[model samples]
Target: MISLQSGELFDTTIKDLLIPADKVAHVQLGNNLEHALLVLTKTGYTAVPVLDPHFTLHGLISSTHILDSILGLERIEFERLETMKVEEVMNTNIPRLNLNDQVMTGLNLVIDHPFVCVENDEAVFEGIFTRRAVLKQLDRRIKNK
Candidate 1:
């Protein structure tokens, strides 16, 4: 639980709100767009992290990225999904946070992203801090006050 004071909310670290990587649904960089789409669909997430075999964070893959990559001049080219890799279309310019970062830092980043990936000093995937978790904390604090 978090302290009710507004100032205390700012003191909260992302570590407390993290959704560990093991529990998060993700796809590998080498996986084909077909596989990526399946994972995204099965998980019901718009986007998911792309990781290497070593579990290092690489980028993010989204259904929109997959769809756009397979779009042809005249119609949807579904065949490309089997040939193209997730690495080819993943969005690399992603917002990241460290476990020690404050909730306010996450609050700022999640304004644009639904979730922000968390990485260690080595850039290894640690987990994610989500907008939903931050909002829940804020809602709790407000109700307590």
Candidate 2:
């Protein structure tokens, strides 16, 4: 539960909510998943975006995906695994929130999507939102008491 003073709750814009570019953690598509795992573990991030050689957004991968591969119940082949590119893994039908969108709209998408890629209609990767970020914002509001 949250409570705030009248002026305390600033209508948070996406620009205000977005994890700034400097704060975003992302990986290149060519990078090995092993290295990606290392980064994820170090940063405590569940997933990260994969970018192309030209820095174009490709897709996202998560720790769960890696764990599924390692569990081997599916018995994936190395060649087939190699073909399992981030573009193939990431949710292409990404739900995004525009910079002008209301904070609650973004919060609704976050309920289902672990992270939503912030972008224009062209789907450029601007930044991402994690549960941590949202909670952090909420914590700020509570502390404003």
Maximum-TM-score candidate: 1
Per-residue lDDT tens digits of candidate 1, residues 5-124? Answer: 657867888888999999999999999999999999999999999999998999999999999999999999999999999999999999999888998899999999999999887889
The C-alpha stretches of model 1 lying farther than 4 A from their native spots are none
* Model 2 lDDT per residue over 31-105, tens place: 665666667898998887776655456667787766565555566444444444454455445576666666677
Q: What TM-score against the true fold does each predicted structure earn?
A: 0.95, 0.69
Q: After superposition, how far is residue 54 of candidate 1 from its true place, in Å?
A: 1.1
**lDDT to native, each model:** 0.93, 0.65
Q: Say which candidate scores most in lDDT.
A: 1
Q: Show model 2 residue runs off by greater than 4 Å.
A: 1-10, 70-84
Give me the displacement of residue 105 in model 1, in angstroms: 1.0
